[model samples]
Structures are given as C-alpha cells and as structure tokens.
Target chain A: MDRSCVSSRRAFLAALAVAPLSFLVQPDKAWAADGQPITKPIPSTGEPLPVVGMGTWISFNVGGDPVARDARTDVLRAFFAAGGGMIDSSPMYGTAEAVVGSCLARLDRPEGLFSATKVWTSSTAEGLEQIATSERLWGLQRLDLLQVHNLLNWQGHLQTLSAMKADGTVRTIGVTTSHGRRHAELAQILETQPIDFVQLTYNIADRDVEARLLPLAAERGIAVIANRPFQGGSLIDRVKRHPLPGWAREIDCTDWSQVLLKFIVSHPAVTCAIPATSRVDHMEQNMAAARGDMPDAALRRRMAADVAAL
Target chain B: MDLLSYSLVDLIPFSRETYFRLFERYNIGVWPAPIIGLAMGLTALFTARRADGWVLRAPFLLTAACWIWVGWVFQIHWYAPLSWPGIYFGMGFVLQGVLMAVVLGWGPILGSPEATDRNHGPGLWILLFALALQPLLGLLSGRPWYGLEVFGSAPDPTALATLGLLLMIRHPLRWLLSIIPLAWCLISGATLWVLSVPTWPVMPLAVVLYLGVIVWPWVSGRSQLE
Candidate 1:
C-alpha cells in the first residue's frame, strides 16, 4: 500500500477505537440519554423529529384480520416505546391508514406521534375527498404531514395541500416519489413550490439524490424524508449474508440495518429515514439506529463503499 | 402513473403470512361454504368425467355457482380490503360465472358431440390437482391446515379448477370462458411470487399446463382427426 493510504487507514482505525468514548464525553446533542434516539430539526419549522420513523407500506396493510391487526399494533407499540415519532403512510397503501388508526386507537394515540400520509388521486376534487378520508381512516382531526404520493397529479394536489396547510387543516405539505423515479421533475417542484418537505428514496446502495436533490433540499430549506432505506428490505437481506464490517462498531451498529439507516440520516439534508417492518424486534432494531455515534463525512463515504462492496 | 414501472413487490403490499391468514379467516367466517364448494367441485369433476349429453351441463352450472360464490363471498367481501384490485377481480370472476352459465349451461353447444367427448387426460389430472393437491401446497410452506386454500371458497384453486374444467370441454366458447380464469392465474401467481410463498409456481404452472394441454394434441397432429 502507499504510505499515505497506510497512514489514513491507521487514522481511521484510531477514530473507530475511541468512537464510543466520544459518544459518552460529547454525545450528539440531539440524543439526550445513552439509548434515546437522535432527532433532526425540520428545516421549515425548526421542529425536532426522530431520524428513524416507521413506514407502513405493506407491514401495516393487514386489512381486517384481527390476528394481523393485533400483530401490527404490537409493532407500533414497540415503535413508540423506542421514542419513534413519524408514522408515514399513504391512501395508496390500501387499509394501512385504517390499520394505523386502529392501532393508535388501541394505544390511545401515544404522545410524540407524528402522523404523515399522502393524497394519491388524479382529480383535484378527489384529492380533497381522499385527504378527508385519510383523516377519517387515521382517526385524526388533522394530519401532521400530507404529500402528493408518487407525484401523481402533483400540480393539482400541491395546490390543494398548500391551501389545506394555510387553513390549518394540515400541518405540513410535501411531495414524494420512490424507486428513483422523476427526480428531474421533483427538483423543479422543489425550486418553484413552497413545500415543507420533499421525500425521496435514499440509502447506502441508492444515492443518486446526493449529487443534486440533497444539495437542492438543503439549499431550498426543505426537510427531506429518506424512504426505502433498506430498498424495501432487499438491500438489508442482501448485505446480511456478508459479515458486518468491522468499522460498523465505530458507529455503534450491531446489525446491518442500523449501519444502513445511520448512513442515510448522517447525510446533511436527510431529516428522517422510514424503514417499514412487521416484526417488533425489527422495529426496535430500526429505532436503535437513531442513537449513539453517527458516521462523519469521511466515515459516511467509507460506509457506503463498504456496503456497495459487500 | 406509469403502471409498467411498478414491480410485483410494489403491487403486493402484504406478507405471505398475512395472505395465508386471509384464507384461514375466510374459511372460518364462511364455515359451510368451503364444504359446499368442495362437494360441488367434486360433483363437477364427476359430471365432467362422464361427458354425457345434457348431463354435462350439470358441471357448468355447478362450476358457475362456485365462481359466483368465490367472487362475491371471498373476493369482494374478504380479499378486497387487503387489496383494492380485489374489487375488479371479483367483478371478473362474477362475469366468468355468468358467462359459463349463459354459454355452457344454456347454449346449444352442451349437447354437441364435440362437447360430449370424454377427456380423461391432463384435464382430469389438473382438476384433481386443484381440488385435492393445490390446497396442500400451502402445507409445504408450514401454513396451518385450517388456512389451506380450497376450491369454491378461495380464488387460487377455484381459478385453477376453472382452467382445468375448460381444458376438459371442447367448444368454441371455451376460450372466452378461460379468459378471466387465465388472467386470475397470472395475477394470483404474481401475488404469491411476490410474497415469497413456496407454492407461487402452482398458479403459473397451471397456466402453462392449460396452454400446453390445449396445444399438445394439435402439435401431435391429433386435433385434425378429432
């Protein structure tokens, strides 16, 4: 190896050695206790949100099955117990919003619960009805955030969401896309629209947003919610076959999920990463990602490289 | 929205466990329906084997009843909540039931010599599989026996059995009757495949088998003589 490469490797290892001690001496101010999750400020309102939120895409769409609904309720219980905040869903996710409402009703609606869903209809009038249905399904008087799901008729829905936000029907309005679709259009919206948040897919394996979208969000003062932190669970499944990298210890990651999540929220613009899970153990592991030491810029690059190499 | 952009995983928004639990709940909620459905399926299988004139219409009527039952009771009431597409699926199934009744049961083709010829071939085997073996495929994945999907009550085996029944008959309108069942075979196959179920191939395999059975006699130059 080159002399400079060897010295850099040694310095990296040295940093890894004292990473946990650094957390104890000068912990990330966002995390108060040893195990409490870390929080990030929403750029639009300066409100603090835990970096790890829950996504209810498939996990909570259990329909009317009592067994499955109760199981999802357990997952949500574990989430709130672990200091989870945002619970993101969509009308497109069929029965998920209702299931969340059922679970919240079961839990009596926990404190610190931040409800986020989307409007996913083409007609502007239907979008308003859909939002009302979402509120009814979620059993909430007002939703904390509403996004134009997959940017379907975003032009019309954004106008409706903006009006809703203005009249205090909704707390925040935004737009979302997944599978890296339509970033160019999303960028145009970010530049022109007055939105509170812009959600897109971002993870260690998928980082196309870093080049432009993340920077644009940072510059435009928009909170960015990173979806598909696990590429809908395929990424973690693929990486789990390999051993956890030795440097994962530096960031207090016991499993590959935390390593992937920390890599996402460590980004300067990412406000939160929503990883969907049906199992309570997985939810607990997901929430744990928000605590302890976060990877720095150099370590973040290395983490991405190591995961990609895996 | 670009419908083609979505993958199978993106379309199916529930786990395999939840899917299996759907059948269990359906089977329990509609208690005597599964029993009646299986009995009707067996009667259809028996009547299909005889292939006697006018008597063959019994199978069509029985299978038609099964389709309507599964469509409304299972698909619309039970499965639609889990997947919004179930509403369309139920509509297709109900249409298939009505088509079978009007075309096969009441049409002039039931008494024709072509429709009466006994088809004790792959068609019988596939029907028997749908009735007796398809539900057992769930056992391979460690699903509970109560959750076993059966014909007349669940969509998968019901669709499969419909294809199998179509294969046994020889009429001009059989293709029209096969449309919804064939489409359902693909849809259910994709759903099971996305859920990572071990028995995912059963539905798609039925499609290939249905197509293969229809094409094989022609490929061997036997259809011309028939």
Candidate 2:
C-alpha cells in the first residue's frame, strides 16, 4: 500500500516485541497463581466476586460451639486474605450459619466477604423468614447469593424469590443440590430459569455433573458453583490412602484436595468450587486449587478415570 | 390415645379394614389448614387499603407450606422426605423463596430496620402457624404412625407435639416452651413394654426442628439470637 502504512506495521511489530519483554519483567495484576478472581462478574447483575470461596459443611464439623466458631474464623480469615469473597453455608449444616455469622461479625467485616447462605425451610413464608434471619445473623448489607438448602421448599421459595428479584432487595439468586439425587431435576430447572448460578456436588470421583450439568450450564450461560469437591471427605478418603499421581505437579496441584478441586474447576462453566475446611492449612490448599494451568476436559476425564481406577 | 401392639402379621402393609379405621381416627381436617390460610391471606390483602404487591405472596407461601407437609408425610420420614420426583423438581422452588425474600423483600417482611411492627407480619406468621396443626394433631390423634410412621416402627405422639410447641414459640421465646411431651414420648416409647417391636415410630425431631427454625424468628423479632 503506502510507505506510511508499511512503517506503521513495522512499528506495531516492534511494540509487540517490547510487550513480551515487559511481561517477562511484570505479571498481569488480574490474577494470582490460583486462577481465582482476577475479577468475577455476577451473571445476573454484572457484579464481580472473587472466584475463591469457602464452603461450610463438614469442614466446620467441630463438636463444640467455641471450637467450631473459632475454626470457621480462621478458615474465613484465610479465604479473605487470599482474595476470596463468597462464603457458602446452609441451614442443613446446623450451626454453620450462626458460626459463619459469628465469624463475619467478629472479624469486623472483610473487604471481600460476599456471603451466600441457604434457606432450608418447609413453607414459602418460613423460607423467606429464614432468609431474613440469615441476613441479620451475618450482619451484611446484602447477600451475594441465597440458595435453597438441599432443595427444601423449592417451588414455593422460587415463586416468592421472583418477586424479590424484581424488587432488588437481593443481588443474585442461585440453587444448590448436593449428592447426585436430583441431577435430572436440577438440569431441568437450569433449562427453565434465568438462574445466575448453580452449586452441585462435584469432584474427581463425582464428575457426573461434567457430562450434562456443566455442559448445559455453559450453553445456557449459567455460572457453576461446585460443592463437595472432596466429596465431603470421600476424595481424601480415596486419595488420602493413595499417593498423589506424579503428573499433579504439571498443573500446580500438589495435594489430593487440590487435585480434586482443580479437576472440578477445570470446567469452563465452573465459576468456583466452595471446598469446606475447618483447618487453615486445608483452606490454603483449597485456595491454591484456584490457581494456574487448570486441566482441560481431556485431562479432567483422565483424572476421573485415574480416581475411578484407584 | 390407645396404641395397637403388633402381632406376627406386622411386617405387611396395614390391612384395608385397619386403614379405614386409622384414617377415620386421624381424621385429617388439618389438610385444608394451609388452603384456608391462603384464602384468609388473600382476604386480608383485599381488605387492606395500602397492602399492594405484598398480596401476591400468599399463593406461593400457601403452596410451599402444603408441599412441605405433603413431602414430610409422603416418604413418611422426619428429615426432608425424598419422594422420587418431588425431591427432583422441588430444588428450584425451595431456593427461589429463599433467594427472593433475602435478596428482595426480607426487610419489609421483618418490619423494617426498626422495632416498629408491620401489619402483615402477624397475618403471615398466623397463616404459617396453621400449617403446624397437622403434625401436632397427627401426633395428638394417636393414629398408628404407618406409611405415616415414616420414621420408625411405632408412633410416639408426644415428641411430635412438643416439637410443634417448640417450633411455634418465637426465636427468643424458645426457652419458655416445654419439651415435656417430647421427652415423655421418647422415654415412654423407649421404655414401654412392647413384647417385641423393632424400631420405634417416627419421632420427627428434625422436621419439627426445621419448623422451629423458620417460625421462631417471625414470631418474636425479625431474628433468632435476640
């Protein structure tokens, strides 16, 4: 074309050459090694929460109230320190909601404390009432997500929730189903609703969500939240007895918890997996799972097969 | 209420004669409680001058309550009754109410950030309280807890009633309610000289525990801890 156009193209290539060298000296601020939130955007409202989060199920399973609450505080502190925002709790977990609330209040609020709790009541009004109570317990301005605990009072809760969504009292809404009991139903709901996110039991041992749910969520543009990444102590039970495979290091996955977590999160539809842990060390490993070089579908299947064979 | 001690034919499902007799004994007029509650809620909304969009919540609340009772009795267990298809499709419905109220309207329903009482709070709680009568009377009527026993072998009505009472109490009033019936039922059920019955009937602590959970906050203040 013209001489100036030729010179412009050369200058652009020179700039690209310098950009790679600048990257060698400086890394992008968007992410840490965990591949967690460089930044997260709420699918419903375009709000972003950090991809790293904490799960409060069996992890905070301390028998005594004090121990459980303190343990949760440490776990939560670790999550926030590591740039985590979402904290998933449920009425099913007994004192988990209370303890999580206690911890959040005790800490005087962390910057990234995006609270998500479930309502496991039987009736619609009761469910709504619990949601109100949970908000008060946590002392947050608003919750990031409110799921139905194990799908108790599912339809009634949803109808009521639709009005709330229209009113804008809550920011985002999602559903959570643990175990493989209602995958088909969960899929159907995802198919129907304009759901922002879904939380399901998924791990290397239980990658069944990958075959259908994950794919459907991807297609429907719904974000996925994975729970039971340790299969609520199954992965640790299985792999704990076995050694970490040699290939674990290829993806920065060093522990069984990290390995299992990494596999679930490797799915593109997966927004994040809330792995519960009472121990700060376990929380560290869990947060690490959000990091670099996640396995692709092929590798995830291989990981599944390996866990199966084990 | 008199209980039937089982004989050798115990393992089989209840006979038709017994089913008819048991059905009459339980006399489940409570089934319509939720329906009536819905009608009243709708009526209340109609009568009120300022109650605007809040009126629409009645159907959803009534339906969820009905299903909760239905689901509880369907599988016959105290924990979340896992009916085959009901458990499947019900997840969305449950989460929807939770997300909606918490995300959207928890404040107005709870009577705002202040202690000022709201008009609809009592109506909503009373409508929900009507739902508790079914399980309460179910235990009180002393029907042979059959497919109803959903929990175990023999029926223990006292525990169920006590559970109902505890649940009916507001969050702060929890200490005021008595579990004498719950304790007596369990102790009697455990100690009573049944020749050889296996597991006891459904006590339903969790089910009632859940009821207490949802209802308590609504009755007293907007929360449980206080």
Candidate 3:
C-alpha cells in the first residue's frame, strides 16, 4: 500500500478508537479525529476549507445598531467556535461587510477565518476601489477570496480579479451569480476564465445548476460555493412544516436545515455551502451539518425526492 | 442591471428586526425630535380645522418641514446606511418638501377661498388616523413603544399625513403636490410589504382612499362652477 494511504488508514483507525468517547463528549467530534472540522480541498490550490461557511447577507447588515452588533458578534463567536472558516460578504449587502469587520474586530479576528468578499461595481477601475474598500471594511491586510458579485460586469471585474490574483493581492479569484440567473453565461465564464471559485444559488428545490454548471466547475478544477443553500430560509421554512423523514437519521440530521445543508455539500462537485443566519442556534446547527455523515448519491436522490414531495 | 431578475425580498437587505431597531435608535439618537414633530403635526391639524386665509399655510409649512427633516435626518442620516436607495428616497423627500413650500405654502393660488374649503368628510378622519392612530400600529407588531413610527418623524406616517392634508385642500395644484406623497406611499407600501409587516397595506390603502375621496366629489357632481 502507498505510504499516504497507510497514514490515512492509521488516522481512520485512530478516529474509530476515539469515536465513542468523542461522541459522548461532543457529538461534532464523532466523525473527524481530534474534533477537527470536515473540510474540502479547493481544487485550484488544494487548500482545505470547511465545507460549511457562513454568509453575511441580510443577517449581518445591522447598520450601526450597537445592540444588534453585539448580538451578531455572538453569532460569529458561535460560528468560529463550531469550526467555521469562510465568511462571505459583498458591498451590495449594505453594511454587512462593515458589520462583519466590527464583529471580527470584537472577536480579535479569528485565525481560522477565510475572509471572502466581492467586487460589485460595474466600472473596471471602480472594481479595484471596491476591492480596497472591502479589505478596509473587513479590517484585513489582504482578503482570501474576492468574487465578482452576481456576475455584474463579470468580464471587467474578472480581468481585474485575475490581475489581483497574479500579483498576490488576493489569494483566490471567483465569480458569483444567484437566483439561478445567467447560468449559461456563467458556464461560459467557468469554461474560459481562469477562476478559482463559482458561487450560485443551489438548494434541494433549485437544482438547475446540476444540469450543466456544477459538472463544468468540477471538470475545470473550480471550487463551487453553493449560495442560498436553504433558498434564503424559505426552503427550510417550507420543509420544516413537514415532519423529518425517518431516513434522515441515515445521515445523522436532527433538523431540516442540517438535512438541507447535507444534501447541498454532499454533491461531489460542490466545495462548500454558504448559509446565512442571524441566530447562534442556527449557526450551531449549520456548522453541525459539516461534521456528520454526508449523504451518498442514492441518499441524495432520496433526500431531494422527499424534500420535493414535502 | 437585470432589474426583472430581482424580487421584492432582494430589495430589502435588512431584516424586519433591524428595521425596527433603526427607528428605535433613530428615536433615541434624535431625542425630542419625535415629540416636536408630533407637536408640529398637532399644530397643523388645529390650524387646518380652526384657522383660515394665510393661517391655512401653517399646515403646509409644517408638513414641508417634516418632509425635509425626515428626508435629511431620518432617511439620509439614519436609514441610508441600511439601504443605498434611501439616498434617492431622501432626495425625493427633500424635493417634496421644497415643492410643498413653493406650491402650497407661498403660492397665491393656495390661499384662495375655493382652495381653503375644509374637507370635513373622510379627509379629516384620515388626518386624525395618521396623527393619533398610525403610530400605534407598531405596537401591534410587538415593537417597543420607542420604535413607534410617528408623523413628521417617520416617513410612512409623514407621507400618509401629507396625503391626508392634501385631501382637505381643494386647489387645482393639490394634485401636483400629491405626486411625491403618493409616490412615497406606494414606495413605502412596497417596502413594508416586502418586509412582511402586517401594516404593509395601510399606506397604499390610504392612497386609494385619498384618490377615491378626491374623485367622489367630482363623480357625484358636487363641485361648484368656478
């Protein structure tokens, strides 16, 4: 056997030995050895990113409200405590980037943070300015990833992002589109653009990307970040109205949100799922989704069918 | 750029909780403004009911100041941080204030006997509703009393009260003055509707009622020949 394979097997055995005690101590440690988070390699550079990341959309746009700011700090604390890595935001999300910066400042800027933001301006020159603004607002010397938000002026912004990536101003460059908008164009960009990641709206209910964009990302060695994993809380809301299926235990899902999250990240092509939430409890549930048994292809099909039936 | 691709929820970036907290912090940060605004609204109401001739312009002047205050202070300084479109909303409000000041406050046409006719029907009731009742609606949503959206202070009730005051006046240019207030009513209604607030329909419903009341006098042939 290969040496790396032997090492992996030894790690697996060590995890098996600690599994029962870890489960008794903290359920999140049962799957991964030493309670480390489950991570997926970014295909471009093979950096391990936690499969579940938090998105600061409406959740972090509190806008100078001190009470709400502290409350959001608690949410971030809960997220980092549960082994979260990437935190994605955009200028278009109003004060979300600023609020995230404030909360991270309050938290002393966690080392595990994978600071991801976007350049949303239509002007190519303005894209550089926006990236600077994002870095300043994030209170970071350099951002880990910068995406072209919603593919707005994707061509210009992507060129700028490519240059930024080349000069080491930003580590990773990506493009994003949500609400399943402009997938054909997104696919073309993924085919041609030398990008690191592509974010798109993907949930159990909305699988339009499954037909083409997802596979293309895999083939092109692009990391896929699934936005709206719960379809902006509506999918989980609708699904929660129905009782959890008995078979949900097969993947160790305790709630509809975990099940929904598990379904998204379980896909082989998907690199991560960014779910935005305001509550600490919800953050814990989302992070928990990254730790447990992920659904297989057969279970994924059943999960989708069951959710669709609901 | 693809405007059609967006939904109502996409336009409202903040949650309903944050929005309510906005008013709470605004009300606290600009303390006594809400009280003074309510006082100005009451003064306008009294002037509209009891005074006539040049005194009639008091309500228009007061309403104009309220619009300007809300545009600059509340919308620009407070709400704009939460949503960028608030800057446009503030500019619209400032323009509305200037228009009200120019057309209804100082214009000779507004003080005319025909223009001063008191609309004692639904118009007065609507004005009263905007003054005393609209602020209470926030309580229904379980918001703290400090977060109550008040007239001359908050945009929704300010716009509604402007529409109510416009309904009372009979000037030909009243429709011209009604344009921004009406537009604000619809815009705010859509915003609140997207926020899923229970009182979402109140502003739009006020618009409907204002238009219906304006047309009813003409529809019933109640207008006298000029």
- Residue A238 in model 3: shift from native, Å? 1.3
Deviation of model 2 at A8, angstroms: 32
Q: How do the candidates score on chain B by TM-score?
A: 0.94, 0.25, 0.93
Off by over 4 Å in 3: A1-31, B218-226
Q: Which stretches of candidate 2 lie over 4 Å from their true place?
A: A1-41, A61-64, B1-226
Give the alpha carbon lDDT tens digit for every residue of A23-139 in model 1: 121113344343456766676666667889999988898888888888999999999999899999998787899999999999999988999999887789999999999999999
Quote the positional error of residue A90 for candidate 2 in Å: 1.7
Q: Candidate 2, B226: how far from true, in Å?
A: 57
User: Candidate 2 on B9-99: residue-level lDDT in tens?
Assistant: 2112122223223333223323443344345434433333233355433333333343334334321331111112224223432443243
DockQ of each: 0.57, 0.02, 0.66
lDDT by residue for model 2 (A88-119), tens: 88655544566677788888887767678887
Q: Could you arrange the candidates by lDDT from highest to lowest?
A: 3, 1, 2
> Model 1 over residues B88-201: C-alpha lDDT tens digits?
888988999999999889866745777766566777888999999998888899988888988888888888888888877788878889889999999988888788887788
Model 2 chain A: ten consecutive residues of lowest lDDT: A21-30
Instruction: Give the true-contact fraction for every prediction, in order.
Output: 0.69, 0.00, 0.75
Evaluated on chain A only, model 2 obtains a TM-score of 0.84
